[model samples]
Target: MTVRIGIDGRVLTDRYHGIGRVTHELVRAMAGTPGVELVVFTGEQSASRRFDLNLMAMLPGVEVVPVALNAVDVRQLWRWRPLLRGAMVDVMVFPYHLGAAPLLGRPAVALVHDCILETDPRFAPSPQVGFAYRIMTALVARTATIATVSRASAREVERFYGRRVHPDHVIGNGVDRLRDDPAAARRLESEYGLEPGYVLHVGAQRPHKNVAVLVEAIAEVPDARLVLVGSADERFPDEVAPAIERYGVADRVTRLPFVPEELLGTLYARAALLAYPSLVEGFGLPVLEAMVSRTPVIASDVPVLREVGGSAALYVAPRCARAWAAAITRLLADDDLRDGLVAAGAAHASHFTWGAAAARLVSACHSLAGTYLAEAAR
Candidate 1:
């Protein structure tokens, strides 16, 4: 039997961030696969952004339907159900865990990246933000079968809802489909300010990423600068900038924002080490991305990250600034150790491929369809 899936494609644009990247990458992969009819419900295409829409358009029978949703049009939001309901889809798949309300009459599965912005009241945006998140969480918690990137996130979801029921599973995220081309590195790095011998860190300066420890470490290792390749957080720039000044290492630490993902490998390849001391993650994607780039990684010895990094990365206490500095210095001074980690990281990264991830998702969807069919039969 054919399973018709109406996927919410609101995030498919040139302005693709992490969530958008995940949504676009997965849909791109899934559309090409054999047995399913994927009717994509998306926002209007932006002429400005660079995306693989031609690849999406070329797929055998996948349909892309644009949904222009606004605050005023509440009922039209779940346009997939109304538009494709007559098609009688076995299930609807929401990649970002939004639009679950439209799937109420039909069996739907929500790919929940994490419940961090919702479960942690402190990180919750505002009253409006908090309320909206609460509603989304409630929808996922009560109705949809959830799919999470990491076991830690799944456990968090389970605990918050006070459920013995395993509402979510650990499918995990995959990295770029692009092969490791030796020549591509040179071509990619030509434009960037290459820090050939720096300790690299790439991510947003969110409170949870524990970047200040790295700043402190810059004072200890005057020889190497910390290359932060993501945007700075305005709230803590005073706190962060002073640490850079206090350490007398303002020259040693550089912060770059919103870089192209492809050039990331060039940055990683040149790094003496990649430092990721994040306090939280649904899954440490940057670490995995770094691993794929064959960059030696020193990350916090936290559960979710350790699980993602396996034995590939050198792990340390996230809160200990001294420990982070020591790890950076060790990796910097020792080429043999760096080579060992690079070999291990490359091997660890090889275990996660887009094909394998897509297969797991296919299995889960088949399972959901089977359950839904049984209920309909009764």
Candidate 2:
């Protein structure tokens, strides 16, 4: 009998951000894996449009099931529970936590990217919202085969749940080099006045992301310009505007709402270094992405960053502006050290590929299926 699998495709909506990209890439790889019939649940009709036919053709043995309901309808979750039940899938994979709805198919595998919601209230619109995520996280931890992107995050998950619910799988996120275009880099340089080399920081201005501290540190580096990319959240404004004004480096900083995919490589390549002083991250993808772009990275000494960047990038204390500035200066001044890091980072990034991550996801799902089957037999 062929084992059936279900995936939540809601993340595929809104142009494939972090979680969405992970879901798409994993599903793309899993389509080739044998003995699995993939069913993707996009809880609303609108989301179906995002999964164009061309993309669907690549995935064999895959079904796209769109619920013909408004997005706000609570029924979207567990509405397809009956359908999944009727199909009797071995495992349903929620690529990210909160993707799990009530009463999902048994032997579910949930990918809890991070416990950021529990760990950082800066992510919450209010205390109630934070509490809700805490409860939701606990539910998934208790009910499913918890899979996470990093061992650090897996430990965080266990910590948040306050118990060893399951031996969470620490499947790392994959890194691939984006397409590079020198012409685009030139244009971006001209457009943004980024002719001089700059330190690139990619990610939202979330408090835990620690962009404010990075900005303060950049002020101390007289020659260094900081390029901040990522959509701004109204709830969590970039709290570093005062620092920017105070440092007299307002002209030195550039903020873009978004970076096109083609120019992302250019941003990485043209940068003197990628400085990621984030206080928390499940997987510091930008570190690996920068490594692939052949840029040296200087990131926080946080466990997750350390785990992901390994020996490929430099690590420093997350909160110390002086420490961050000193690290950036060291990388900027020493060409030999920068060159070595760039080469080592690429070698390190090579160890993480989408194929490897997909294989792990498949293994996790299969293992859960086998366990569920054995339990049923008893």
Best model number under lDDT: 2
lDDT of 2 by residue, 87-125 (tens): 666788888677676576577877888777777676676
* Model 1 ranges off by over 4 Å: 14-16, 45-50, 70-80, 86-88, 118-120, 164-168, 177-190, 232-242
Model 2 regions lying over 4 Å from their true place: 43-54, 68-73, 86-88, 163-168, 190-193, 374-378
Q: What is candidate 2's TM-score against the reference?
A: 0.91
| TM-score for each model | 0.87, 0.91
Cα deviation in Å at residue 58, candidate 2? 3.4
Whole-model lDDT per candidate:
0.72, 0.79
Worst 10 residues of 2 by lDDT: 45-54
The number of residue pairs in model 1 that clash at the backbone is 0
Question: How do the residues 106-217 of candidate 1 rate in per-residue lDDT, one tens digit apiece?
Answer: 7777777766665455554456766777676765667777878777778777776653334335677888633444554665446554537788887777667778789997
